[model samples]
Target: MKTVPIQIALPEDEYADQLAFLKKWDDGPKPPGWELTPKAVVVFICGGSGLRLENNQRMDIAPKFIGDRSLVERCVVTLAGARGLLLVGEPGTAKSMLSELLSAAICGTSALTVQGSAGTTEDQLRYGWNYGMLLAEGPSEKALVPSPVLSAMRAGKVARIEEITRCQPEIQDSLVPVLSERRIAVPELGDYSVPAREGFCVIATANLRDRGVSEMSAALKRRFNFEHVDPIADKKAEVALVKSRTQRAIADAQALIDVDDAVVDTLVTIFKDLRSGITEEGWSVAKPTTVMSTAEAVAISTSISLAAAYFPDSGAQLALIPGHILGAVRKDDEKDTERIIAYFDKAIQRRANANPNSPWAILWDNRHGIS
Candidate 1:
């Protein structure tokens, strides 16, 4: 019998070629246990656009985090020091993506991670019991279940914790001693301690609007250097991201849909208007409480392409963006639907009338199904 194998590689494993290219280019001293120099790491996150090689060949490194290079620099430097790095932001601001990119660049493996949630147990963060081994060998080292945090501590690798605030505050504080003391105390095994090797650090994310989140304790807060990850502020940049991501999705699905540039622009404009409670032309539109993020824009853009792919001859009517956004906005508050409706009447329709035969007008025409 023949068996098939599944290959699931981390970002580092997948991008070995780029990593090798960067290693060859950079000669700066790296911190202990880092895979790339600080400059090279920066290049890895913020693309080395139009960068020159040793042979004078142009090299283009694809950027992961579409924000400030200095912010990325600060994050990398934080993990190189004593304090743990905490990424705080609104949902879909690429906090997790930034963390994974940082982890892959620094540790050579982005696999050591703990996803924090309301149901996350203390054992998940620290250690757990192997009941079978415990029953056989009475509280021995063999009976201990090592967690991601413990594994990183022992190996001196980067460990990630997603949605840290979602975890109960008491459960979250379990890291105070582990971080400050640089060790995990396992009392069940005769006060066993797992000392953190050099370069071991924690990168955690806290969503501003996460459900059932407890306020982080002051002591725990002191142990981490917090960085705010804001959404993309530029329109062209956001549109480019949406197009790139949606095109990738279309290719993955083997869909031959070309998401129009005009459609992409209109969708992004709607999101920005709804998010800021004001139009590009200075109209006061009521803001929706729902997060109208760039990630959401990418998702909606991809979804629209997929819709075009599946539905026969649906490419002609690619302006049902209002309908798609209607679903996206009504998440947190039902009253947000009214705000969306008001936006159609006040801003979008006016734009359609003002800029006749454009995608805005087409989207305005499709506003009927939004309700």
Candidate 2:
């Protein structure tokens, strides 16, 4: 069974449902050519409940990123004002997802995107010539291959640049003029240029934690409004996100949805503990080397449930394997082993001891062998 990428874009029928899920945007003015008002886009991206589509159907577009609605609101407003929107955050914080959802909702397509990397050249963000056509026709318009940004500009839609910081500063600065002047110049063919249409905009995402990231210049930054996305923090919100994500994962994995509530709680606890460096009981645990992101938690929980369903002994009890948890927590760093072990011994072990039949007790007893 092939799994499809989760569709973040809401169908027109689902637009109002999506609005209902987001916060009510009371912002002053809206951008041109937006499907929803700037305020509605904010509400759709962040978790809020005041929007409605013309159709009487109750739409249900879930808030994908569990962060502050205000932050999302600012991003929408920035795009509404035709300023570039830069989403900067740690890895796996859903920066790209948020950007994709925003672009898809705003422009009706998320496919017009540039994935930035160290090898990415100016041609990627700007325009490239089709070498075959260029050789045949000598730099005619037919030879010009417009990049995603140029296409978006001509079409008056949002263009997405993923991992903008991963591109070299030189490649990134190519957008300074496109953003500021709202046009791309092609000097090779008689100074041909594509001026942006009314609704044209750019949404770029960068990982702040990447080691080789090139900082955005102040001049370039001035062309955009930056939004920092934090990881999901509230327990109830995190649980809801995990549950929603796990359902999607299970559907994608083609696995049975036989996971237990206790198992969900346990996975959430591990994520919260490792992410925040404290247990649910407020016991401090050393930070692990791994990121402990909500995304990872959803993956681990889904994997455990699938393993239990397919494998013999593991499948019967629906019990989480300590080995799976250990593998999830103790990634990349040797020191993480000690941190995970400490967490299990001091926090999980203590809790399981108080309630002998606790679902985590099996995990607590088997932690050593698994690690």
Candidate 3:
């Protein structure tokens, strides 16, 4: 028998499988044009009790991200009001993931998104011209091309603008009237305007460390609720997230390997300590000037797992972690390697001496990657 791997589905598709269950679980009050009640939306993100399928079997849902349940609820509420929701945080903290999840749950589709960048133009947020048609027909409605935001407005669905701060201030402000008057005027198309529908809303994400992010104008800022997404705080939860996500990635790659929990723990520890500027032994290690987010931990863990899967019997290959850490820590600056070496000297060496039998200590013994 041939093993046919399952195709990865979108978040909306995943939730669609449970849409009936969501409706049955809470048929209470819902906002206009919402797929589920606000209460059920809460259950969708934070996970909940009492859901079943038509087969009379219990249906359990997993909470997507580990964060404050109240935070997710606030996002849902903001969308219900058809206002803008802005998620700002350091890179790799899952700000985009949160937006996608909320959009998937409420609107049932998260595909209407515009990736904001320095080169992003106002036409992307408002409307663009079908130049061929414009030249032939002389700027009629047929020549107007709607942007993702315009489409979301016309459809009354969620419109996601990722890394909004990366866009120029003038381009970013193109969204002001969209959120304020809930409309987009296409002057070139001869008095045509696109009005947002009942469920129309926008979700945007920005990185705190972004240098090219021209400060959002006060007019744009006043139109949206800003949420600061922090990095994973709990050590145990962070470890579990990395382990589970890395395992999923490995399995998705169709590679068979059991990434030792001890290895996962050490990786998470180093990332958290470096990110927090403190060591497990409370030693002050020089922090790398990089955004050491949990996503980076997942990447390093998955890479190690893939390597172990391919070279199960290679002892040296299994101990190549220090090399991997050295690589993961140095993103943009060569000086970051010095921070890792200094950390190895002050913290890793001390910790290894304290716990000589642990997996972390084994990793510490391989610190010559920097030397």
Candidate 4:
């Protein structure tokens, strides 16, 4: 019996077995380096709630995104069709997570990733020479160190470039031809080049908020089909996301912290108000410079739960919510505090009126006490 790869992040080991067992299956031909076809990639990631595995294991892979199912389907299709995919969104949107999931599901390895940063170099995008070996021996294939992108091409697998915009524009542009030509040319090595295998593709992510840092060149932009992953805005969706994420966080922490719905509601409300820069009633307020993302909300809520569990008497109530919200919002400007205060008074105060147990209200009452 063949064992499934252990590196796959899905809770299940053999997704193929899970797919077959879950009868809701119709898959196209698998690509050169992919375990499943484009269609199966969709079903695998989105999950099959009613499907069953061979050993009676249900396909319990929970849906990751709260957005349109069609968008996910489209992304999978785009990748399967060999088109380069670019997932652009604000900070904390699940672009990285989504890329990892897709890479794992399709190529059976999500480790082939290049993290974009200010110091990222062309060697990272293409291939780097083992400098010691290169100095000892002339420019030879033996001295060449293949980057994740090159390895992905040679292996016919998907390569992920995260925070593509964070890399300098020139460095980021190096991927344009690798995407369009689907090959990386190395004139120094020999009269040969690295030709991408049949299933090779690039999945890059960019942050809209980091637009000015290192913009993706127009040519590079033209090489990808962009998909913007937005934050989950609906209260119900946001609540579900936060609850699930918080639960996982607690589980990871090995702590028995139970976050009630009231707490979850308060956290979601604060995140939404601060993100949208307006009350639920459409009253406009000054917006903060910091990013109020769902990821941050999950993190903040998890912290609050741990605090409540460990120090129940520390007065971690609605009053504490503002401080947490303030820390998350006041990133680049002091003006954000005024906006946060306005939101607390207009939106949070009203919410507290409706729900007296709101943790944010405690923060509002003790606003002056917070630094």
Best by lDDT: 1
Give per-candidate clash totals: 0, 7, 0, 6
Clashing pairs for model 4 are 318-359, 318-360, 318-362, 318-363, 319-362, 319-363
Query: Which portions of model 1 miss their true places by more than 4 Å?
Result: 1-9, 50-58, 211-214, 315-317
Report the candidate with higher TM-score, 1 versus 2. Answer: 1
Local accuracy of candidate 1 as per-residue lDDT tens digits, 1-371:
89754344577877888887887778779898787888898899898877776888667998878988899999988987757999999999999999988999888878999999889999999999999988887898778889999999999999899999989999999999989999998888777889999879999999999853338899999999999999888888888888898898787777887877877888889888888888889999999999999999888888887887788566444566887899899898889999899999999889889997878778778888687
**What do the candidate models score in CA lDDT, each in turn?**
0.86, 0.77, 0.84, 0.77
Residues 1-371 of candidate 4: C-alpha lDDT, one tens digit per residue: 99864433442343446544433344446666677667666666675466554466555656766776787888888888888899988889888888887887777777899999899999999998988988888799888889999999999988999988889999988888888888889889777789999878889988888764235678887778988788876889889989998897777776776866777787787678667877667877667888889999888888877877777886754445656777777778888788777776776667668776656556557767434
**lDDT tens per residue, model 3, 132-151:** 98878888877788899999
Q: Weakest 10 consecutive residues, lDDT, candidate 3?
A: 312-321
Clashes of 1: 0
Q: Model 3 RMSD to the real structure?
A: 2.5
Quote the positional error of residue 154 for candidate 1 in Å: 0.9
TM-score of each: 0.95, 0.88, 0.94, 0.88
- State the RMSD for candidate 1: 2.0
Q: What is the lDDT of residue 51 in candidate 1?
A: 71
